[model samples]
Target chain A: MSGPYGTMAEKVLMKGNEAIAEAAILAGCRHYFGYPITPQTEVAAYMAKRMPKIGGTFLQAESEIAAINMVMGVASTGRRTMTSSSSPGISLKAEGLSYLAGCDLPALVVNVERGGPGLGGIQPSQSDYFQATRGAAHGDFRMIVLAPASVQEMADLTMHGFDLADKYRMTSMILADGTMGQMMEPVSLEAPEVKTYDKSWAVTGTDCKRPHNIVNSLYLVPEDLERTNFERYERYRTIEENEVMYEEFMMEDAEICIAAFGVAARVSKNAIMAARAEGIKVGMIRPITLWPFPKAAFKKAAEHVNTFVSVELSMGQMIEDVRLATECARPVVLCNRAGGMIPSPEEVLQRIKEVNGGMTK
Target chain B: MTTQILIAGFGGQGVLFSGKFLAYKAMMEEREVSWLPSYGPEMRGGTANCSVIVSDAPVGSPIVTKPDVLIAMNLPSLDKYENAVAPGGIIIVDSTLIARKVERTDVAVYYIPATQMASDEGITTLANMIILGKLIRVCDAVSNDNLEAALKKVVSARRADMLDLNKKAIELGFNYAD
Candidate 1:
């Protein structure tokens, strides 16, 4: 797989959504169920075009709910299965999300988010941050949320999502905004290092050889449900400790710290470089795993940073996590755009300049 | 070196397709590249644009607010993105469709009658590729070495006959007196 750069992996120019579908296939995902949605239909379209050729199942369900329920059926069989959608459709899939968590099923769900509270515009947005990170559904459960900034990460994390879901026996979400899903970039489609998990609990036909495994989410007894919630929280704590992923840029001597993820992080990097050229001591902490929140990294940055800027596409969602992570010790300001607009590098740099100016006072 | 490019035109003008060609060429040359299109619920007559970045360094943002090269296929696109080009950057306009002079003094502008050239050459649908040829001449968005190889990658095997026609259109623009 060598290319022009000797020994480097050969790369393909693919759209983010297409990369996700391809990577999922490489990761052994044989079943895909999803409805058409803006900014994410390409995921289904790619699967539709390719799945039949490879003897895989690509079902365009009647609705988002039907699609997710179909995912549940395949997931119960302990096979790699997935579904993808955008913001409004993701909301429609929420109950299925809670059920996936409740049943402890392993599956990958991709949310290429667009603007929303209702039927929002089919434009790139990170407004689903609160919906993805905090309130995916009604119950008290957390899904492993991975945010990808580039198309390369979109593919890399799709493979990673499946592995994580299998390891943790729950749903793993690719929480990308429309920009990440729609952009095209060069990506190496090499197979990822995979770790297999024991799926003996899966409800495959027993053939009268062993006891039939039952897959159910209902716990009629209140205490039984409480125990399951406690057990899930215990697993969450373990994931927070062992699976937190983040990247730090120019944080060695930073006076201003910017907290962002996905596309906001990409724009912030551009702004950070410009600020450094102008001699502003600013850096960024980009959380790759949104659920874990990278609390320790932000807490450490808070110890030295004079100000923290929470850049987002939402009104303000991850900013609350930034505040909680930093213990509100540093003043965290918002540099944001809502309803499908992105905060440009100029806007982010301007915010940094303002935060630095306030430090002198 | 990092070159941010913005290509804009009518929806049917192959704006995104041309950007794809440039991105594929850059990838073939082992440069870090990205192509991001302005996608949504738009019909054929609506305006469409694409942002492309070809860089020696990793591309930070795929959304190019300040492009080093601007390829405008129509007047509306020119009026929209003319002011957005960086100082001393290159602006390549399809002169046959956009009848106005560029009003920017800070950037170098190229007015190529791409549509006219393509129509004259009986390759009307390739005005995008014609302007793209001029784009490569004006800036190092992609190397000329991998142009055909890149074209082979994007123009599906079913349309293999188009490979030579596209190359001819590109050569037409590359050697155009304008």
Candidate 2:
């Protein structure tokens, strides 16, 4: 609630997916192209009704592939544009996300993930952690991946996601789950101003006022392509240095730390609260940006809590990130639930106690 | 203190709407409230249910594992969620559809023939409202003025004709609660 985010209005209950759409609208996003997918169709549905009223383009593209292309087309005109989907649908748009990152264009992508490896049930799952954070598409590119823990974050992240995409001239993704998508909570939202950007790279139909800009993603010369790749990686480094967002809860004097993001983080919060109530000295570090992975928070937490639990919906994807972040300095554990099942707070609390017992031995 | 409630019935029986009304009521009172519905295949003309949590502090988890109050419109919902009620929890059952009684002796049970009450009043769909009225008497999570304001926001203008009937049903249930 504090920071230079923006002026938020009074509180009102909004669904996470609907709030995402509303935030996109507030951020002056006039174009949205997405395919219908469970747990995330609400994004398209809300856009379908709201966009027309605001004179925005809300098209249900033929497919996820087509939707991302439509986003590319819209983004090239110096306007905010977005596309949303679940895990499978995001995979379909992986190539386009690569293209978006390649062209140095700004775009927002929302993935309200459902269970998956292949058409997993339409239940909340964070199985796409590796997919979203480790490069959703085939390329050496990075996206500003934001993981929202609540419906309020679902709305607020869309505002910041667009700004970060435009600020860095790259793609930003709101990595949410079906739980955050379907859950309802009080949110205070503010409408963004009619924004203008330095679109020197945009191929605007400028009436010969300036030279026409060509927007394409083809690099034949290997030397030229390598230069562009290195340039993009430099920008990624800046994002990693400056834009890594994370949250630390009750870390001081704590012996056990829970590292999670999004819905899993919400589950962990409840478990941490219960553990603290029972005198367990447990804490949590929630990664707001999945790309940067908040290694600094882990470093700070490792000074006290030598044991960490990577709570996730997958068997173990983020656990790898935690291990690499801590550099194996601390013993890392996993408490996971796959195939659309959510890990309850009690289950996570039990894991904390078990890990604590192991530490004593 | 936090009040966790579960409202369940067939999909067409206004199960979700009743939960939403309570959630909206809590929100109007500036209380931290969360409403979570059982989504996906479980809610397509089949059994539908929702969890509503109202608290003074921030709600930690939206999923209600054990409910402080259970509003069951039919037999199956009662059978399914009966065991999930906490000790001393209140079970409000629609006697019109559920013939079985609450088996737990630790909890208080209030049986209301909501459907029959609505049908007798010539507004059979007001059963949810009737049960809500009884809940207001038992829980007192929100005041009547707040509940009415929330109902007005929920009811569309085209359904204006049914508002009076719903009000009557709510009042009747409120007075009939024993």
Best by TM-score: 1
**What is the C-alpha lDDT profile of model 1 across A191-225, one tens digit per residue?**
77767799998999999999999888999999999
Cα RMSD for candidates in order: 1.6, 2.3
Question: Which candidate leads in lDDT?
Answer: 1
The number of the candidate with the highest DockQ is 1
DockQ of each: 0.77, 0.54
The residue-level lDDT of candidate 2 at B41 comes to 78
- What 10-residue stretch in candidate 2 chain A is worst by lDDT? A1-10
Off by over 4 Å in 2: A1-8, A193-196, A359-361, B42-44
Clashing pairs in 2: none
RMSD of 1: 1.6
